[model samples]
Target: MLNNQKIKKMHKLALYESGEGKKHLAISNYYRSDYIGLALIKNFFLTTIAYGLLLLIYFGYRSEYLMENIHKMNLALMALQIIGLYIIMVVGYSILTYIYCSVKYAKAQKGIQEYYKGLTQMKKAYDREERRNGRITGRRTKA
Candidate 1:
């Protein structure tokens, strides 16, 4: 699977080298991704906001339902336990996001590098062809 991905990337670069289109890979890889960091920050903000909104909605409904646990959270056990659970959840989410982003960024860089490598190969091929053709004054080398 990984080999297939690499070959696909190489083919894409070769296409670019052949002047198929502007290199999207090079453009994307030019910038520092900070992909995982940004994702973690965004996730933290979103998760906290979502949890806060849920708390608000629960309390608002509780006022109507007239429940005993009006403002309390369902921590279940001790404060330490709740904190531990929160830590674990956040850490797990962070790890998953980091892995995803890292893979994407690395792949992007890989693709662009392959593209440049392909271009180098293409340049060499053209040079050799030109040398062999001897279209102008130079004598063609016998194949």
Candidate 2:
């Protein structure tokens, strides 16, 4: 005895599992705050590395000027300016990462909720089939 409704639901579930379900499951495993925090940490490190590379390129381009002005330049002020720029870059990127991760986590949780609802429906269908076949008792108790 094959149920068309059950078969359709099963097909849908299979498609989801093969596609976005993997990402949704992985995202749902983490707490919202934890996910956002992890993203922020990664963002910080990436920003730091990018900034370092930019500094190296800038110094390379100005090598001749820097060498000529080495004795005349205000080294302390220049260092302060570079530190300030790095701080700004890191803070800006962290804020964006936090917002993006928060939204992503929320969406994933919503998807998992829907998936669970589908599973519940499938379970009920199986119970109904069992009752029709006289394989079980009067009522099906949920666990």
Candidate 3:
């Protein structure tokens, strides 16, 4: 959404000042609001899917040989070999996805904070201008 900043800027510029314009402004306002950022969501969901798939693949393959032989100790070592590589891969990717999620989460939070700060400043500016224009201007700032 932040990546669409230029489009947002242009949209703000093409103000028709209708009720539709107000709704559009509200939508963009929330888009840039301090609620959620796209990157954090993207990474978290992607990592979740990847990790889920990895687990499913691991357990599915493991089940093939072990379901019937679960209580059998004779083929334990053989099962371990087949399952060990999957474990290693899952662990590695799990760690990687964790690191990625952490970074993306922080980045998204920073973006939200910055966006809210910017929105606050904008509301202040708008209120000041409205006051100058002799219009009621105390709603957002009072919040």
The candidate that wins on TM-score is 2
Cα distance off (Å), candidate 1, residue 142: 22
Compared with the true structure, all predictions reach lDDT values of 0.64, 0.89, 0.55
Best by lDDT: 2
TM-score of each: 0.54, 0.89, 0.45
Off by over 4 Å in 3: 1-75, 135-143
- For candidate 2, the lDDT comes to 0.89
**Better lDDT candidate (1, 2):** 2
Q: What TM-score does prediction 1 earn? A: 0.54
lDDT of 3 by residue, 1-143 (tens): 13265456445544433334444344444443232344345545665677678768877988877687677656767668746865665566556655664555555556545555656665666676666556454444332
Question: What are the clashing pairs of model 1?
Answer: none
Instruction: At residue 60, give the lDDT of candidate 1.
Output: 84
Models ranked on lDDT: 2, 1, 3
Compose the digit string of candidate 1's lDDT tens values, residues 19-134.
62344454363454555667779977776776567657866877665365535755456457745756766778778877877777676667667666777775776687667568
True lDDT of residue 1, candidate 3: 18
Instruction: Put the candidates in TM-score order, highest first.
Output: 2, 1, 3
